[model samples]
Target: MRLKRKVAMALTSVVAIGALSACGSTPSKTPAASGPKKLQIFSWWTGVASSKALNSLIGVFNKKYPGIKVINEAVAGGAGSNAKAVLASRMEANNPPGTFQVHAGGGTLLSWINAGYMAPLNSLYKQQGWYQDFPKSLLKMLTVKGNIYAVPVDMQRSNVLWYNPAIFKKYNLTPPTTFSQFFADAKVLKAHNITPLAVANHGNWETTLLYSDVLLGTLGPTQYENLLTGKAGTSWTSPGVVQATKTFLKMMQYANTDYSALHWQQADQMVAQGKAAMNVMGDWAQGYFTTALNLKPGTGFGWAATPGSQGTFAMVSDVFGLPAKLSNKTATKDFLKVLGSKAGQDTFNPLKGTFSPRLDANTSLYDAYSRSAMASFKKDQLVLVIGQGAANPGFTQAFENDMVTLLSSKNATAFTTAVESAAQSNPL
Candidate 1:
């Protein structure tokens, strides 16, 4: 559930510059001889659960490739905002890491691929027999033209509502399935002096994440996908978008007062401590709840699809790509091989609070919430996550900035107009 950035312009600029350098030379493809090689792996996974999950994956790699030294270059920021910035600098300077984490979709990875910073992994996919392992829908995201660019490890549901079961039980409330029911529950919670929702906007992308769920909830999966994909009949200024914006503003009314001051972990903390009744977030909060807060899945916390978004799965996946000009191509591919393997995915995703993207994953290894998520992922119509990797970087940046404005202005029409304008310029 590592969302993305607010520094859209800087990232855009860096990619443009990197593209120039990328054109000047072709990267080396030869594998270095296997002797104590050091492979630098870069990512934005420094949270307690994510770190543990990464370390476990590294441990697995260490066991198999004992000769290769894995360098963990993790940077901390909500949704990889800080790390993406640093990675952009490194990529622009032509000093790429052996491999790096990226959200798998047009918004994030496509930029790197288009700029020639990433090498196509079609050969690796064929070599590992991964064409049948990962779901076709997921592999579609990793593909540009005819070449697959990265290996996906885990799949996360972005449109989930995590709640304090005790709070719901105390108020005799069921998890809301529709926005009206959600409002009703909010009324009860607020009347009881309990914050109805826990929100965090420290990175400026969380609100946009909330709004993305609202859009899916309001527009339904069909029109929501149409709007995001810029279907001929759809527009960001559609009535559904307006209503969703208004709904987002209304939902904000029940949020904690200090939302701007907290990160996502703290916001999840509010629900864990019973300071808030519900939180609309990706399933990564499950990791925080189970690992950091030491809470159980069913009794300690509860979950449901975000109101009005029952059948749709808003997906965000974490992937690692082979960067061009790597000094240790053999070591990087070894890591990617492990990353895409069934055993490796199983080992990492459970601890990461996500489900493996592999269609044949062992569901028994996952927890209650993760198993439920995996089921939805298999059957539900999947939509890429906004502010994560649904749209291009330019549009994502604009969407986040407009969400910040909408927070203070509470003007749904103006926000829709701004977003629509951005979509026009950025081509969705």
Candidate 2:
């Protein structure tokens, strides 16, 4: 199904206001009712690690507001494709949940804001002193026309390369930091009858995600951002895009033959079981490794920035916003208060395998991998992840479709042409 197409249709009004800056009036607050209420929290976080993290956050909310009942409306599959479809239906029917998880960016959250489906949280942010808590860059992402629409809970680094330490050591190999070194390592691994890279395209967005990293690694962060933002000198068919696409196609040669059939978690499992030497995925794989596979960090697995992407952090954040016209507005605000709290973020992000977007979160609660990521998030150049929340839904949909075709055709020229056309139609 064309999931992003549905999203684009639902949020068609976003295009008109896409270029507007973050400036707007503050919304008035709604006082809490004195009786018990039920709040439905919606998301696509049914996986073992994500589900556990959600439960922990809900448990905190429950303890604080015992009079409110939280209903988890989590739908599984497609890395939120299924959940987005369900959410769109509920929103259209005016059966919006109390609050729902959304990615923090113009392409995702701004669509909901511009469509008038979300409530501005400026008053809430002021009440909670969140302006100082979250980083300026993060809050900026959730803002449009001076109104902040969502509260980001966690920060995940998308440009991560996870490798099996045992497999690397057995081959006397280390993580590669450049494409030349990556191919060299792949050659060695392949000679030993090992899959060099573990990949999964079940959701059709994984390869697109990989290509985003390849773009950043190839063009550097500035040019990559320029291309996405439709800068004057940058174009989708530029030499950098061509090189990145070629690199992406070459990397696929080292991936598993069954990549089309496996889920993302299954691809992570390939590295866990030593069937594959490496996988390039978001740091969420850290949660699956530690929580589901019972593997320890540092020794069990090693991680690095995707080849040539060092000193840059590609981020995908999961945020929640107060939907407009909710009966449990007070309860939802209460939940948002907790969600954006330092205590709540510290409780949730440790188990979720991500860093809290709040700058002052307790670092001791996180693991070695997460602590490292947190450090990078603070000092490195940050970029939004494509196919997650960086680009508009129309472009994201076209990009995913093009990646799927490139998998079979391996036609780099055709890939660039299609993507350039998508950029023109979608306007970034």
Candidate 3:
């Protein structure tokens, strides 16, 4: 319904413009020459593999659009906090960049739209025919109030469990199926003086991942969606939710002693070095492991769907949101076209260890784990993870705070209460 309406509106505008262009009674005059424009893009990617991937895209973008100079404004801080803070402040000041990084969620972008800091790209979307290439479901994610606002670069599956094959073989353990088996394996690994779960709780995304696994794995799909959507009077106080939280905290006891300060990369190093048995993070970690640790799946390490979780894959795609009121410059349009093009996605997602957001891209470009993820995505429905994507950025922060406190204190009751308060205190 919405697509039809938008297409009709675009056609109407095109016809109207055509009528006006036909009425050329006056002599044509030479157009004024304009200088090249510079567009600054702000992002938080600082890791070796991530930065390399981004630079590769930037190099391609520069070649495709010669008149545009892109100045990278990358800030390093707690996960993505530093970059996010700067973007928020710049947007509020009406000094938004030409393009900025956005997560695959409704929370942060929705807030920006409400604040009048966002510009819809519906007309541009129609002109580029992105709707045909991007899947209907994936496109629906960036659509709000009947308008498209962003271009997704890739989709990250957050419920992946990575394990060291050498360690598993040494322990004579097979991949665990149910949650009971998972805990039992952890115990076995612990007795043998191996850190079973490699976790780095320093970032908000890490905390958010823990929340996602607990909610989706333990609370079940219906209840998880109900709680995230505020459709039911559900609270984290439920036995299922509490039990999940308790299990998460208990699992941390088997983690490395330096887990408190280690980053995800450091934790990944632990698994790569065979110092740890397992690590649960997004598939993007696979890129790092492959690049930095020289890992090969089914040999050095392996990937699996998180155990004890019976639900669809929960994902948040990384996208680029252009400023709404961009300068009517040729360079700007060139950049937008490149982003929406086929070559861009092909060049970006494979090295980043994520699949392209476009539904029509060649899945053959993906790695083994990515191929598995694509297979799951095709068969299993995808649910937008609320903590990462649907809820407001502030609400995400609140959840993160509660998680950090709960994990460090190891108090399930306090954690449940904190989550309840966060849910009740609407950040919208």
Candidate 4:
């Protein structure tokens, strides 16, 4: 389905920037004002709870680094789809924000790294001693070759299934652990006039997220990771992926009719308000539920890995990377140091519903869902979430378009062909 809000705005400046940069001349921004200037930070976490969580962290940052004004310029849309386009326009104009959100994985990072628009944060890592603080596995995703390029803000588990516990109790149901169990429960819920799945077809990124869970559940860990990273040469066209697409199609059948018209949060609200039983969304929904809606973790809401994805953690990191064209590198780097610190992440992640990317973050500050995610992060088979992982951004768009096509037609053969072709055309 096509997105409701304009998701992909045509960034003509990107094309112009490409042409101009090829000619060895790119526009230079007029330098920052003579006095202390505002460190304009760009991001997409503009929702009520996420905004409060970030603003709280900004409060702390201001206390630590006085005389610097921290301006949060967030343009909201799922997975930074809208913000990324806006960011590309600004960066290409050589009017980069001091720092902006980017997926820590190659899916979002490789293009920026390859374009040489990012600064190498290796020296910052060494200077701040962050190598010992963050998880090495996550660091690996954030790294290109031997250099780390971003300061990770938080970690989100993409395959989490958030459901209304009261709705489950009323339906005499427990969280399903497999697809068959899920379908069995879905039939009962549907008969009882409850929408079994909460999904948003108004946006493609959320659809990609929803399908990615079903994809992970069907393909399992090793093959799923391989396929996402382009390590599995033959699996792209395999029956396994087609089966996953089929499962995704079946899951879509039980969704609300207005699912196509609703945004991801509206779809999620169907579950939260007891109009639906479950939602296939990321753990960021946790923040919305707990902080915004004031729902408790174990009592009001519950979380489980998407069916058949137990022992696997499909995740993405929200990170801030420095642009090479910043007019305020000094203030930006100082803020980055705050982002990398334990105090900073601890203050942010609890309310944001993400765990700290750092191994040493205080777990006592985390709730039940976050604590469980942290444990799974350590022991589970971790895979970079394909929607936000290491693939080219164009490839992500192609994948999302194909996913929407597959959902509508339910043609496994065509879906596989389209995805395989997209991957071939846009390799990481």
Candidate 5:
């Protein structure tokens, strides 16, 4: 077996190193192996919760493939920007990891799939008979030209409005279900010297995440989808776009001071600590509440879909893809098997604070918030996170820059015009 040979070579190398150590000589720092024997999986999940979730799956993966060492090559940064930059460098030099993480939908990273840098996993999906296991709609998102490029690990709902229950009850304020209601509550919260909304523009992507929810809440799902796919002339100068911009500005007026100084997690922590009334962010904040903050889900916090977006689920699926022409194909494929399994989903999703993409995953393993999320997923129209998921990366970046400028400018018309220009200049 290949594993047996690898073990033999390692033992011999260790003995040789021991012999050199006895001579007061330096031993080689390189791992002595016949060939590639480790599976390096790179991702932005260097944070506590996401890392724990990935590690839980690794625990299962080790049971399945004990011979292969799973290396956790995590790069820490918000939006995976730091990791994305590093990945681009590695991929440019044809030195990619065994596998890397990406989103499952829209124009995000479509170039890599189209460029043939990713191996088509269609055969693997067929071998596992997964055609019916995953939802057809989800498969549609991951597939291009009849090939599935990656395996989705979990589904995260992005448009959730998280709030402090104790704070809301203390102020006799119910969670807002519409923008009008949100503004009304903002007034009351402001009167009490409490920050109404918590937003962190530390990175462009977090602010984009916040604004995308407002875009969805304003334009609704169908129009939003049109904008992503560049249908219906899809210019950002549209009336709906203007309305969304205005709405975003209005919300910004209530946000915490020096918001750009905090990261997204710190904004969520404000809600968890009852220092702020609410935070409109993705469900990862739940993982922060439970895993890091050691707080109960429904008891410690409250959640609803972002105002006026009740029937839509703004989603981001964290997916993994094998590098092109992998040296350790067998190990990477075996890891992919774990990524797509119900058992793997069960172990990973609960800890990750996201729901399993698999319909058959054991829901019992998820928390109360996740169970509700899972239920809503089936009912809500699945809208992609435009800034991070649906739109082209270049366009998304430009849009983020426009949005950040708009935060200070408060010039909705110029913002919309700049966004329209960005949309026209970039390819979908």
Candidate 6:
């Protein structure tokens, strides 16, 4: 369930600038020059692939700028909630790290921006010509009141279904294209004693995927946004939303008995090992595919969005927030330049199992799914996931909790009530 890495385990700490002088670890003479300083970067990158991605980017930075060293101070956490708490404590103490991971969305880094805890990147953005490279949808996420507060690293498609291709072929099943077709296929899978949905409910993010797919499939893109944005009331009891819940309940009924105890990797393994038929997860699950299971993306497994979705995609992005204290400073400016540089994005994203933030990234370096995601981004139909769409972490987790309770209990009325509660209590 834990996704972030232990910084102490993976990283060798560099002595802080002032600490070098305190310990007499610096060169002889005038009290240790703190010019073009080393950066202590904090992140929640735990997996081997994730660690490799961060270290690969650092390797690039090491070559390009010999003066600045990036000490990656990673922390093990649950989908970044633990990291966020630690980051807040540091900011409260007025001792923030040089950089930390944040999502590109209205509520993620914008609060820090508005509170003067994060730096604006207008100058760096313009200097690096990022305005032309980043997508408009991503730009909207990073911008707060017309000021850019974060740098987007990569994008992940939230509404993806990973299925065992061999199972599909043996069962003579084609990927479903509509909700009705999906349900029909589920029956076929169940008749053969196959678990249609391989889920890991104990991991909160895994459950959130179910809620997103249902909401998006039921409400479609436009109404889903309206509901999340508070433009419409929770009419969760509405035919569409309720029907979606029931539909999801049907899928859940076919789940393996140990779903509640499994982690994401275990569910992915179930499909990979042919113990299950399908999994609904974000695109990054492919990392567990190619690397851990030695499976190819399209050959060993396959990808498709939820049926009846009309090409609508759900997403959340990994973005970097610069501390407000460093915005106008020359040293921080130099670091941000490297961060948004072509080489920086190139080295970071492909290896990270996500699409580059810059629209101009060389797609040749990515695998099949990453390439498809980039192509999908160009179509401009991405809808922000519900958790990432909320204005606060409280709302995000509450929505996920309520949905989990609702589906786990198999009560449509209770689920609708929970949605109504989320709508009124959270207020977007």
Candidate that scores best on lDDT: 1
All candidates: TM-score: 0.88, 0.88, 0.85, 0.87, 0.88, 0.87
lDDT of 5 by residue, 1-428 (tens): 99999999999999999987876633222344665478899999986668998999999999988888999999997568789899987787667788988987865557688767888888899998778788777787788888888898999999999999988888898999889999999999999988899988787677788888998899989998888778867788889999999999999999997888988889988888877889988888888888778888777989999998998988889888877756557789999999999889888888777889887878788789999998888777887886657877888889889888898999999999998888889866
**Candidate 5's TM-score:** 0.88
- Tell me how many residue pairs clash in candidate 4: 4
lDDT of each: 0.89, 0.88, 0.75, 0.83, 0.85, 0.76
Q: Give residue 166's lDDT in candidate 6 (0 to 100).
A: 92
Off by over 4 Å in 4: 1-28, 77-79
Quick one: ranking by lDDT, best first?
1, 2, 5, 4, 6, 3
RMSD of each: 9.9, 10.8, 13.4, 9.0, 8.2, 8.7
| Residue-level lDDT for 84 in candidate 6 | 83
- Model 6, 164-185: lDDT tens digits are 9998999999888777787787
lDDT of 5: 0.85
Backbone clashes under 3 angstroms, per model: 0, 5, 2, 4, 0, 2
TM accuracy, model 2: 0.88
Q: Higher lDDT: candidate 4 or 5?
A: 5
lDDT of candidate model 1 versus the reference: 0.89
- Give the per-residue Cα lDDT of candidate 6 at 408: 55
Model 1 residue runs over 4 Å out of place are: 1-35
Model 3 RMSD in angstroms: 13.4
Which window of ten consecutive residues has the lowest lDDT sum in model 3? 24-33
